[model samples]
Target: MTQTAAQAGRPRTRRAPRRLPYLVRQLGTLVVTLFAITVVIFGLTAIAGDPARDILGQYATDAQVTAFQQIHGLDKPVVVRYLDWLGGLFRGDLGISYQSNGPVWDVISPRLGPSVVLVLFSWLLTVVVAVPIGLYSGVRLRGRRDASLTFLTLIVAAFPEFVLGLILAIVLGIWLAWLPVDSTAVSAGGLFDSPTAYVLPGITIALGTVPYIIRLMRANAREVASETYVRAAVLRGVTEPSLSLRHILPNAAPPVVTALGLQFAGLIGGVVVAETLFGFPGMGQLLAQSAASRDAPVVEALALMIGALFVIANLAADAIVVYVTPKLRDAVR
Candidate 1:
């Protein structure tokens, strides 16, 4: 009985140790990521010109600027300011905007939704269109069909987002009149309210990502298609759709998922120029305004938010890769 009890206790003891390492690693990653973000935020704030002057204007006296800086704790050491910022971040207080004189979250949170909506719609559209086309091109190999598709993808990919955004704005918004040209505000008509406003932006974002996904999917599918397993299945008269979807796509998913996560992270920041050009009110636009106004708190908060998003997205991708590829999980074990 004592031996059995000891054995039972051993399992619990071993499990605790296993968990400790995982916890340690997670904490370490958080610390390192936060430290790096702090450095970047500080550097950006320093180069962005005097926040006090930006807040008070050029006509403000030197004493006024100095007093403002002192009141805001800008007179403190950089390390102290960073620590204070980090502490505030932990407590969900992102600080006030010097320009807006409002809570940072209040200003940024509203715009975040619009940006997310745009990116999510674009991402879904890209995936839906790219996957099948990429699979088709890969399965067809060097055929005329594949060559045609590849050429088209390259052409589309080569086009810059702004250029595409302009062409789309003119073609769809002006000539076709399918969407609004300059409107960026979301309406009570819901997501489908302003096709003129949202459609072109969505399409531009989607188009920017499509070529990358198509290329990645095509390469991965082609490689999987050439594998012995796929060849065996083909020889056995396996149905094309089933074989591609079940056997091919699943195996080719790791890199695709990785690319998708990275693109999603990039979309968070990349939407700035597109959002600005289109007059969209999103986090990107907010960041642009904050930077232009030298709203240090808002700008720093936005930078940290974007950085956190990137890190989280990467972590999510890693988890997904491990989940899908047992080999990876086992390696970790």
Candidate 2:
């Protein structure tokens, strides 16, 4: 009777943490952070230059500039202009791109899908390649294989994304002619039109991120492998594969998952470089082009959109971590 009573109470003590309140608090923080990002974006764009003058060019009369400013509500006080822009966001208006002379969304929406696919492909490669190497290094923990991997990952990590892309372009595209030099030849269908175009840029982005994930995953796996539970499982004569999958992997995954989430932001930056180098016509290339042209509306819209993506990625990661390790629930609040 006592054993039954104790067993029943054990389940109650380990009750899952409430997730709703934690998620609510995180959402609140996300809103405040996004609001702050908007303020900074709007302020920077406001002071950069007069968009009307830039768009209209040097020979435009004062009358023409004034009409353009008034038309875009740029003549309004800065605060009022910001508020109007903020309100417009809620109504799905991203303003007009000075470069395209069209709605900002219409110009960017086409590239959005391809950029997302690029990032996801890059991230998948990072995880698939990094995780196995990290796990193996951790299990080997101070062996020759681990030492060699440490050296190699560091060497790979040292190269900047553009430099790495350039090297790959030279070796694979020029020397061997295995793939096209640039994605310019790809049809309007984007990366899917010729999947080969994605190979170099995708590898470039993944290599840039893989080392960090590998290091973090290795550290976590090593720590988990030393735990009492893992030792006990070993004593029980568990097979190596089963032990790793059942014990170490799950225990080490939460932190790596969180890191992966943060890496998405870095991946976005990589996308910019990769797209520009490869002429992939994704958001990164569009952003670079717009920035060069001093297209304030397009730049501001892209900045906000990118910021939102970063926030959403982190939010999803946090939720996963909390779900996997309920101990983290209190930290969220």
After superposition on all CA atoms, what RMSD does each candidate show versus the true structure?
6.1, 7.9
Per-residue CA lDDT of candidate 1, range 139-236, in tens?
76687777888899899989988898899889988898877777564634455466556666777888888998999999999999999999999999
Evaluated against the true structure, the overall lDDT of model 1 is: 0.79
lDDT of 2 by residue, 1-333 (tens): 999988988865577866667778888989999999999999998888677877789999999999988877788899998998999899999998777778999989888888888889999999999998898778766977788889989999999999999999999999999988787544367558888878888999999999999998899999999999999999999999998888999989878988887787778778889999999878888888888888888888998998888887787777777866766765655
The best candidate in terms of lDDT = 2
Q: Model 1 TM-score? A: 0.82
Q: How many backbone clashes does candidate 1 have?
A: 2
Clashing pairs in 1: 179-196, 180-196
Candidate 1 regions with alpha-carbon error over 4 angstroms: 1-27, 187-196, 226-251
Which ten residues in a row are the worst by lDDT in model 2?
183-192
